[model samples]
Target chain A: MEFSLFNILDLLGTMAFAISGALAAMSRKLDLFGIFIIAFVTSIGGGTLRDVLIGNTPVNWMENTNYVYLIGVVTILTIIFRNKINYLKTSLFLFDTIGLGIFTITGVETGIQNDLDPIISIALGAMTGTFGGVIRDILCNEIPVLFRKEIYATASLTGALIFVLLDELQVNTDITYLVTALTVISIRLLVVKYKISLPFFTLDQKKSPN
Target chain B: MEFSLFNILDLLGTMAFAISGALAAMSRKLDLFGIFIIAFVTSIGGGTLRDVLIGNTPVNWMENTNYVYLIGVVTILTIIFRNKINYLKTSLFLFDTIGLGIFTITGVETGIQNDLDPIISIALGAMTGTFGGVIRDILCNEIPVLFRKEIYATASLTGALIFVLLDELQVNTDITYLVTALTVISIRLLVVKYKISLPFFTLDQKKSPN
Candidate 1:
């Protein structure tokens, strides 16, 4: 609740995710209520999951009305600016990337605060960074891009690992956060730009027929 | 944790849910690992969400290895008896209904134990009973049946509401649970038997185009 650089980035991340959720819902042609629900989940679903896993009671949004108000505002704005926002795809993408970076760090730090294992912390970070979109895609009745084509979770994982390593080495907190967030943002941008993706496995045609 | 009738019913519910999940995954033609993951989530997803929302840390499955083992065994059994299981559609439906009933009670009790309002407890109960399948359907890239059709969530909600009403009157605990579970099971069975479903809503063509 204190105003800080981290808090500011968190708000930005929430706003970005909310807009993306609204856009996705609009594409699905959901009613206003459905769009609101999807946007709400897409913005906070990951953090809510993380907090739940860590046993953080009442979760974050329940404690702070600001997040709820923020998402509501963002959803309304996204709806109003739908066509104009389509022209700003690059800007939206950048915001989403930034959100991914910030959220991953937030998850990792939360895990550390809870004294979880580094491996689990990294998993939490990637999940926190990516699961909102996963939830969004699921509600829209599509395979999550995370499990299919993107290096999204991998990027979050990489940043989380780096953050943990730097933290373990007792690096300056501010520098560690900056480096980790930048690393995630850069990896996502580069991989997406290059269309890089992990190889997908397919069942043998003779063994399994669909 | 106590070796009570409730505990027995809980385990049975877990097993039934796991089998249903494995069956669903198999039908999807997912590989063995995918099937296992699906089964695991399907059995525990709702409860995990419930526990997390209420700030119960480490979640239920983490605190108890029995659920993990039960799901694993159930998944293996389901795979081995997949064809035979298909012949037992009636039995499977019965088990699923039983699971819905028991899990609803468990969720409502947990919420009440945490001193939540009756309305919130009822919501938790319904969510606990139904969200596992919601997650399963989402993972399978389909619209959740809960939203589209079926009296599934409705049955759970009805049972939850009845349970809350009964509890408010300080009814006998054993009788309360039994009545609640039976109410849920009977409602689901009747609904399905008669092909009853909630009416669907569609946006007007003039208002929205796809």
Candidate 2:
């Protein structure tokens, strides 16, 4: 199938999410099926939630089984390199950050097609990028990185708003998409690089170490 | 709040699910927060998925914070009794069975209210009873019991179909609810009691003995 740049990005985003999930499974020392489950949920859980919210019948994964195959390969790769790739943590982080940015844009695009307002689109975009990881963490019985890690939904929110704002200013959709994706990835990567975090409600660091 | 018999049953059902989730967490040796997450999802995850499917906004648990506190208490109780309650496994199974049954009926009822066909209601009911565990298992990085344990959902499907059949025969709604709940609970308990399992698609266990 001839995929547009956006479609290609969507696949990349999915691959990234799946890899992150597989990495998490490796960390848990889970079995093969366990690795696949985490990868599948991490890659698709957010999009599935969004589809349900938008009343998309059959869901995207059910619509296209290719997604299933993609995640399958993702699990195999992570399993094969489980120990060797631990040192490539920086590269994995980059993949995850880039994937988050691309996925956020894809989510906003989905929301717009359904006629949601910009504010809602921004929120949906962030949800699309983040909730899968939250679900993954919850399954792994850990506090969600999105809930406690640095500048997560905030970065997606800003990028989504940027896309919406640029569109309102009559920018071409393709350019808007590219700009938003770059903006999101940059902000996320820079935050991680600099140990920057958004201000959030916290009782005390002693209370929650995660 | 005004409560009907079924409503009371619903509360118990929620408590049962919460307790099951808490116990699962306890078995895994999780901390207080992990137990809380398990209890919360086990209690509310199934219905939340159903509601989202039917386009109900804000979700059920989001509207009722009381249930959150209820799950909180249930989790604490599980934590406290973790060592002592291994002997009470049968009672716990009974509670889980009853909870699954009532939950099935409740989900089907909502689907019927939305004017979905009875077949869809049957599906909704099964989804309601099964999805929380699916979500729970997925988060815990395991293949959902649904994929491997056929009888787990078969009990729900049978009970849901029976509920529909009783309604078709103009059975009183109250009696119908009672019979359906009992039927599901009975089937589940009996299955577990007898070590009954569904034959695999190949009539051979697909899993490695390892």
Q: For residues B116-188, what per-residue lDDT tens digits would candidate 1 score against the true structure? A: 7676677678878988878887787656745443567778878999999999999998998999999999988
How many clashes in each structure?
A: 0, 2
Q: Encode model 1's per-residue lDDT on A1-210: one tens digit a residue.
A: 897776676677788889878777766677564566678778888788888778787777655667878998998888776766533435445656777888898899889988999999999999899888888887877667586554778889999999999999999988989999999999877887778877778976685555
Which regions of candidate 1 fall more than 4 Å away from where they truly are? A1-8, A88-92, A117-119, A147-149, A196-210, B1-48, B56-133, B136-142, B146-210
In candidate 2, what are the lDDT values of residues B94-158, reduced to their tens digit?
A: 55677788899887777677776676677678878877777666766665555443256777878
Each prediction's TM-score versus the true structure? 0.59, 0.58
- The fraction of reference interface contacts (C-alpha pairs within 8 A across chains A and B) present in each candidate is 0.22, 0.04
Candidate 1 scores an iRMS of 7.8
After TM-score superposition, what is the CA distance of residue A62 in candidate 1 from its true location, in Å? 3.7
Cα-based lDDT at residue A189, candidate 2: 72
* Candidate that scores best on DockQ: 1
Span of 10 residues, lowest total lDDT, candidate 1 chain B: B201-210
TM for candidate 1 is 0.59
- Best-matching candidate per lDDT: 1
Q: Write one digit per residue (lDDT tens) for candidate 2, span A1-210.
A: 458776777788889989888776556555455566678778877787778767784456544556777888877876675555644445445656777888888889888888999889888888888888787777666677676655777788889999889978989988998899899888877887688876557564575556
